[model samples]
Target: MSKPAAVAQAAAPAAPAFDVARVRADFPILSRQIHGKPLVYLDSAASSQRPLPVLRAVEHYETALHANVHRGVHSLSQWATEAYEHAREIVRRFLNARSTREIVFVRGTTEAINLVANSWGRDRLSAGDEILITHLEHHANIVPWQMVCAATGARLRAAPVRPNGELDLEAFRALLHPRTRLVAVAHVSNALGTILPVQEIVRLAHARGVPVLLDGAQAIAHEAVDVQALDCDFYAFSGHKVYAPTGIGVLYGRESLLDAMPPWQGGGDMILSVGIDSSTYNELPWKFEAGTPNISGAVGLGAALEYVEALGRRAIGAHEHSLLEVATERLAALPRLRLVGTAPAKAAVISFTIDGVHPHDIGTILDSEGVAIRTGHHCAMPIMELYGLAATARASFACYNSLEDIDRLLEGLRKVRELFA
Candidate 1:
């Protein structure tokens, strides 16, 4: 072979096919500077930055197809309704839910949880019944059930986490008793980035005749989710966490389960007929979705899912895992840095605290260095309490993140240490 041919052959298998540079280009904000330094956004677990396609999709909806969906017969209304329903179908495919009837759009994970807590819990739960969550759960998963417990006189039971930050699976399984009405857990822990064994959790709950709801706000972007394969009764995720707009999320429930549950909120769209007497509610999904939904946000979420599909989730997962390894190794080497979650299986998140420095102080220093990280309890205060930590500085990775971003984070941590010392 010629020299050029050999060189080309060797290089062909050297690089990954998924182009990180091209992916980064899709997000315009990645190019901007923060405090005169290039922005290193490591807070994707909180809310990912929107790509150009998602932005354009929202803009197109507002400009060309702005109408009240499902309530009008005009051409524009028809177009808007088509777009809105198409977005629901996209969510259905994204989660591999059985039908569009299973998909319910809500404000976000918080509202979705509230929907289940109010609708499902109100019916199935009774006094002394238990809801099983985990120490790794975000507040969205925790608080709704707490409110339900308070309202219905049911009790909330939390499974513990191991010292390494992984959920104690045996303990979780043991918690599944006949009195356990529902099992609500996060598929991925936002604060610790711990990937829980959700499939097993679902199976265990099902064996005990309890329905499981997997909170996928952090898991949706990191992996492919199949509700059928997991056999979860309910799953919820926020669009903003997956590079879509805020104020829109999805709740996927089994059609049988959703049909049995009453409406969480009564509003214009959720009702069928309202006379002087009682009113009839809408069908399965719409029965849960009240009032005017976040139509533009749903369109953007559909576009974001399409964008992720084009990128290929397996490739994105591999790239993100590689970044996590790089960040973990680099961050672990820093002096006086204590990593919070040391689970063997984790997503692209690192929460750490430097000795003699508060997490907020670390956050401020890193912010000054143009690296964005989440500081504090990260809405999982129970997990913090379990770990005996008030807060930790968290840096989460996404498809657009690079190893260079990790380097910048390391540099910022060094600066933090220097300032503290």
Candidate 2:
């Protein structure tokens, strides 16, 4: 779903300041214990846990309004249709899009990116054309463009990233030349939590006549996004990453661009009329949506967005920033521990490694202590190789996380270090 333009940036108003304890109460999973210890969940970058509101929303829709939408005239169908379409409006409002037509629902960010590659890339890209991405991109953002480029004989170029895990903007700008057709980048690095200079990236790409697509899976839960303000051609994100269920996501495209692009997949809901000779596709969003969509998932996603909005985006940002600061400092103070991705501006994620322990081992010990964290290349092997590492222990935060969570993480890390020692 889309957001209001007002809360899209770092400097948005922080009124009704975030209340962490109050917010934590809304998420029931936080109360669960692991290994006889209170659960310290810090894997939100992979998937955020759902709150009561989202869960209830999904349950309500499935229980009462479980019917196929847009084709039926019965009461149940009409109710289902309203819930689904209202979800579209929620997305449009969440992203500050001009209309609901620009918001196309897909399975998740991966599918959204693939949709653009298959539809837009296939239609517009040709031999010798170039698609530029960054070294810090998640594989979801990288592989689809690679497949599209390989199919079209278009070249793929990766913009350099600095030693500190920040994008080399100078190198990125230099790579945009006559042959560059698309510039795709992540708004927030999933591996490092580094927020990219997307506004500048958009401006530079547009100056070079290249359209931009932002992978915002890691950005949406932590901050507000306005498609118009960024002026990006497309923005994609996953519902699970933002506290909704899996198998639901959004792709926001400029109305003109989407209108001109052909449907990536053809099915019943996407066609206006089908004939033995020829077929006419449905309008903007449904044309892209294709089949019977994820009705309940959309309803849950709408409720999730509303939940975030009521909490205040600016306040959430501030709260998470504080957690990151504390977590970074405490982790840095640990003996023989190295922190990765120390960008000045970041979301609430920390990837690190202990001197004598494998990241997997670290994750294992942490889990034993009821401190859940992620460990791997994080689907960002390119960035991992760039850092000359195999993997890192990643602790990513959400609205439900707290300073005490970081404390448990640190305590768990100390155990890992002691074990290795």
Best candidate, lDDT-wise?
2
List pairs with backbone clashes in candidate 1.
none
lDDT of 2 by residue, 1-421 (tens): 2222123233446533455677777788989999999999999999999888888899989998889999899999999999999999999999999999999999999999999999999989999999999999999999999999889999999998988888999999999989999999999999999999999999999998899999999999986799999999999999999889999999999999999999999888999999999899999899999889999999989999998887777778887888899899999999898989988879999999888899999999999999999999999999999999999999999988887888888889888878888
TM-score for candidate 2: 0.96
Error of 1 at 288 (Å): 1.4
TM-score of each: 0.96, 0.96
lDDT of 1 by residue, 1-421 (tens): 0010011112367675457777788888999999999899999999999888899899999999999988998988899889999999999998888899999999898888999999899887889899999988899999999998998899999999999899999898788887998999999999999999888888788888889999999999997799999999999999999989999999999999999888888888999899877999998788988888899999999998988877778888988999999889988888898899999989998888888999999999999999999999999999999888999999999999987888899899889878999
Cα deviation at 305, candidate 1, in Å, is 0.5
Q: Candidate 2, clashing residue pairs?
A: 1-91, 2-91, 2-93, 2-94, 2-95, 3-94, 3-95
